[model samples]
Target: MIGKRYTVPVITLAATRRDVYGKALAKSRTEGLLPVVVYGRKEQSASYFVALPDFKKVYREAGESSVISLKTPEGALDVLIHETGKDPITGEFIHADFYAVEKGKALRVSAPIVWVGEAPAIKLGGIVVKVLHELEVEAFPQDLPHEISVDLAGLETLESQISVKDLAIPAQVKIIAEPDDIVAAVAVAKEEEEAPVMDISQIEVEKRGKQEEEGAGTPEQGDQTSSP
Candidate 1:
């Protein structure tokens, strides 16, 4: 399932050129816009603003690997959503960076891994441990895939494992990882250890001893201080 190719619709996002500087960036967000920048191999970087709702929809569909058409005032530019910034507390989009795709050039990006099918080892009381969530790959922007699917059915036994080399990658894409690197593996689940039991009698004895020691240091309740 590694090299498998699937067709994905070309995703497009609308953006407007933004010249806002300094404190104005906050104003853009208040108006339902997100500040973003676009740059490429030999292209000039430019700042722009995109609708928050529209950008969110495109991000969900294109992710980081897939190329999307960014419709700007100048023209439509083919780009990839390279990075994003968010409001830590509110989880709202604050900014984004888009990588303009250069035609005829290969781009190195991380492709997310999608697990397909249920591992047979899981039914046998074995747990599947995923080691890699994404693979670093290089391919032409047009050949880039939204994601790489890894079939879990290959894991039949608890000892079964999948390595980087086991992935069936597309002919155009090259994986930038060690061939022997384990991608996923199945292992026997460990039994939960029992909690240590406390000795109630020993605890009670220590508490009583502490109380008696404190009482010995105090004078009798009826005793009065001797007059000097």
Candidate 2:
């Protein structure tokens, strides 16, 4: 599903001012500014306010792995979305943490899996399941992918499976997950066997027969009273 595209998308967000806290932070959000922090290896952590709309646009595409060009009054910084916080009730974007990454340094990041095409096994009544959804990878900021495409076309039979080794990744990126890790697979659904039905009348007869057998092996009540 992954193919080389000539055009690379440019994601940018402008940071306008310093930290906005308490009532001021709430006021900034009401005014459409999102409070964010940018920091990374060998870089000083700094707080800035970004436009909510602009950040949403970049986040939709860049996610947390892709490099985002953060424009500040000081200069442009290449950063990654380290973490994000959202409102629990409304699910609104509340806060964000961006990591400033060095140009050529390798960093560990998680990339989401994107499934493409339909598995042939699924057409034949086999269930297709994604065993792994995200892949941990080590790569330079520029080499990171927004999402790794996993082609379901490889699953031709019920026993077919896709592993990390089968993924098509760029040479510059290194997958942190084991090569034997399964990405997707197809399995034949087993038909559930119906439980055996019990014969109530036959069970009652058996109970009676057992009672009669025990009674025959025992002495009468009068004979037992004389012995006592």
Candidate 3:
């Protein structure tokens, strides 16, 4: 089991019932509201709106894996951030999808991996390589963890490594990934010397100089006298 758990922040959103397509969506952005949809077990998919700034704050803290409570007109809903849409030009949030989750229901989600403590091998010129960024886990909605912590302090030598089976998670949570899958490792950092860059213009000038020297050895047509 994890030694410490992060507190997931709760965010409230006002339910919107207005049109969600065409010009209405553009207007919603101008008003600082983002269009969002919520759907999941025991509920029909519904369109709604949330404050953009508030949602962005939650996104930065909770990310997509952590569960957050969404307050709708119906009541408080436990949900996970399923996905989000961004504007390509301005890099702004455009839309969001929240997956409603029921308490006591088991669901599979990708939990992010967080590395803690510096590997002792790093001081010996060893490079720390991350073998996996996230792990697939199944747990009840309330038991879902925000992130899995991997302690690098155990890596005392370059040959030391950690695998999925080494992770300490809550008993309620089950990692779906293979136990033999490597989570991280420390290895000797490969040092490569930079190769000298050749100057194309210098090479071209040298070739022209050689051609001129060869031409000088052979008399020109006009320079060729009767003694040719």
How many backbone clashes does every candidate have?
A: 4, 0, 0
lDDT of 3 by residue, 68-134 (tens): 8887877888888999999999999999999998887788999889989999999988989998998
Q: Candidate 3: misplaced stretches above 4 Å? A: 1-14, 190-228
Report lDDT per candidate.
0.90, 0.86, 0.82
Ranking by lDDT: 1, 2, 3
Give the winner by lDDT: 1 or 2.
Answer: 1
Better of 2 and 3 by lDDT: 2
> Can you give the lDDT of residue 40 in candidate 3?
91
Question: How far in Å is the alpha carbon of 135 misplaced in model 1?
Answer: 0.6
RMSD to the hidden true structure, all candidates: 6.9, 3.8, 6.4
Estimated TM-score per prediction?
0.77, 0.84, 0.76
- Top candidate on lDDT is 1
TM-score of 1: 0.77
lDDT by residue (tens digit), candidate 2, 1-228: 223433336678899867557777888888888899889887898889998998888898998889898999899999999999998998989899999999878888999999999899988899998998899988777777888889899999988999999888876778897888899998888999999999999999999999999999998665344554
* Segments in model 1 whose C-alpha atoms lie over 4 Å from true places: 1-8, 190-228
Q: Would you give me the overall lDDT of model 2?
A: 0.86
lDDT of 1 by residue, 20-135 (tens): 97787888799999999999877799999999999999888779999999999999999999899999999999999998988888889999999998899998999999999999
lDDT of 2 at 80: 90
Clashing residue pairs in candidate 2, if any?
none
